[model samples]
Target: MNLTRTHAHAFDAFDHLATMVAVLRRDGRCVYVNAAFESVLGLPRRALQRGRVFDWFVDPATLKVTFDAVVANEFATARLEALLRRPPGAASTEPLPVHAIVTQIDHGEQVLLELVEIEQQTRQDRETRTLDQARITKELIRNLAHEIKNPLGGIRGAAQLLEMDLESKALREYTQVIIHEADRLQALVDRLLAPHRRPHMVSDVNIHEVLERVRALILAEFPKGLVVQRDYDTSLPEFRGDGEQLIQAVLNIVHNAAQALATRRQDDGDARIVLRTRAARQVTIERQRYRLALELHIEDNGPGVPPEIRDRIFFPLVSGRDGGSGLGLTLAQDFIQQHHGLIECESEPGCTLFKIQIPLP
Candidate 1:
């Protein structure tokens, strides 16, 4: 193939795709960068066309491994999953998870690379920490439940004994409230330990089955005008996972969406919940990139997640709903992360999208 014609066709193809693509000389000088690259990196095409690829990477150490992989031709294509820091003097230098793939081209004289931003790494890290904290919390709940539950039983007995001697109706009512509140707290503690105490049943499970069950449960509860739609890719492979945990995780999310739709249903509004699944390629989770991943999304057309609570939605006890326990999302996140997956949410006034990506076994 003629080098110039080959380059032309490659450039044409790269320009047509949505992902960021760039080509560099073996010496690391940028030779071609598609429009997507310019748009994503916020750099001009002309500025990057002739510049060295190293100039764009904020960290020198990262550039070294990436360039070395191309020069050595160790692998036809090498992928480097790194955090790309913004350039100095920029408004913000927040680290972004980037999937950088280097491919040797033109008989090792040039390197073609592509980059995609995987935003779930930070969320996964946060979730892993949260899961560890949850384990500690479960231990605390177990200890507290045992300590308090026994004393409460004795206290309730003592209160009943006192109530039998007291003639004042007000005093009896106060004792009843105490017993009720204690029982409520006990129930709450039980929920806290529920996930940890549950038996782990590992099996080869299809993700769509879990989503379908969740969908059915949600639709059954809100059958009037709320529509639960599914957009699933049936070709995805089964993964070795705890099906019950997965079902609980997906159900928590969908149930929350259903509850969010309550107000809309009252006003005869359009309440829509969408369950979508797809096969994601080269997805990175918990700082590890897999060749393939199963992507699941639970989106709702409600008032959307409140902006004030959006950032902390996955944290325990943070909720946007009234009278919500606020542990549903936190538990859901913990379960998914245990399966080496992560969940993310994006919300506005009219739409809220929660995305879950898990690796295939």
Candidate 2:
């Protein structure tokens, strides 16, 4: 392919995009491929230029037709879904689904193709909704806790006075139950308000060290059967965060994972949890784009989160297990959000993975 200095300079800008982009003639021969395109296809730019864009898609027939229609002046732009084959042995063997958009470039025969990952769009939408819901939930919880708090103290104090005056043993027993239940509810309310009330202590925090503390705690608690594996990206740079809070946040996730493996533990099966850390580039968090980010995956080889409550897992008082406080994940989410990060969860019958993403400095 040959291009004028002006055309080459203009096309170079596409490399900055996170979306996969390509330029091709009306005949479907590739003229240029952007950096994202090269990365996803796992092919070099020189190699990509050797093949027509039509050949890269699973349904080449549809792409070819779309190309013909746009070039024929039927429409200047078109959007369609197609699957792109990835390199062998990728993490997921399934073909990547993308929303392919094609637009005619001015009056020329060249058409520019931009591919947005379908799954990524869905994830971003979910993240946005989750964050909105969490903000509402945080405010409601804090307000409710305060309302319930004052009455709770009064009730407990009254119960204590009544118990002191009661001569009958039975009456005293009833007062004891009231006092005990009040204390329990008080503890629960305290937990509900903890994240919002606690001051965020900021400093340099190494992600590996945080994971190690959680790992040690999980191992100590479940000393028998569970295996906590570490797969750290040692080169990841430390970021300014509250190390103690991070420790608790990651600990909550690890602890939940360990508890979920109870059946495996009872049977002395191979119960395992993997803590994986990696550096992510060109990432978006809460609508803010960053050049680099840190990604942590807390994966377990246990029965996945129950589908019934999976969507509400981070909401306060939502839990799959009976007698569970259901505040662990809620607190975890709060801590991560303070750092301008997000946590996403995926689960199936035999596997569950929690992915935590925080921007890097």
Candidate 3:
């Protein structure tokens, strides 16, 4: 391919994308490296000009096979999942996981390589699905609550009238029971629909302040046999959010952890929970990229969520414990989603981590 001034000008647009783009010759020498290619790999564009594609790849043999296919015209395009080398530095660097696609350009004389960080892609896909699922779930819950609520009022009224008309106290007991149960169901329905009733009240919120409130509340409740630790990055900046909603979300998670730890085995009596915070860069949430985001983790040392209901833990009316209303986590999820954030859980025996990430302005 001829490198005319016009063609060079055309390549300039690729530099603005978040996905890494590189142009290479049939012999594997890099002809051009986009801004993303260098920024993501933590390498200078000039450094990439010094070596072949083999320099960054983990497995030369496998990469060579992929290159061979593109070179021979056997395959117009090929993909490889490989570990990318980190840039030289004074400290430690680990191999970064990346997904790469190589396509023939200039009719097999040149190749176009596009690379995406696997973790970023995974997060974007997961957030997209979560946002979709949350929408569906919210609609379903609202419809179901409305249906149950209308009938519950009628039942409670009928029970109250029956109690007033009854001369026999023995039969009045049954009427009272009916009225009490109806009221309980009414409350449940109201709780299910509570998050949707209020508009998001956004303001500049300090994440540490929210965590501190939750910490004090939990420690006061579980004054014995429970410990809460804080590991905060004080450098993190405050962002726009609903402070009350964030406080409630963190409180629900920490309260659940404390409840689980209440039943900890006698041998491992030192039950603990940690509230950690950090600032994340180049984060993609709900398919939109943000320059900065907040990562808050509530980790606990308690028996993990039961496998039977683990998948449905966030669903309304689903609970791992007996007699639990199961609305706490559901409400927490709803509140987070309202802020365009995500809540993810990872659990195993003696370890559970709930991560909440919200984009920062």
Candidate 3 off by > 4 Å: 1-21, 31-49, 68-76, 83-98, 104-110, 117-123, 265-267
TM-score of each: 0.66, 0.91, 0.85
Per-residue lDDT over 255-276 for candidate 3, one digit per residue giving the tens place of the 0 to 100 score: 8988888776234569899999
Model 3, residue 322: displacement in angstroms?
1.7
Across residues 247-274, which tens digit of lDDT does each residue of candidate 1 receive? Answer: 9999999899889888887677688888
**lDDT at 70 for candidate 3?**
91
Question: By the TM-score metric, which is better: model 2 or model 3?
Answer: 2
Number of the top TM-score candidate: 2
**Candidate 2 lDDT (Cα, 0 to 1):** 0.90
User: Model-by-model lDDT, in order?
Assistant: 0.79, 0.90, 0.85
- How many pairs in model 1 have backbone atoms within 3 A of each other, for residues 3 or more apart or on separate chains, i.e. clashes? 0
Where does candidate 2 clash, by residue pair? Answer: none
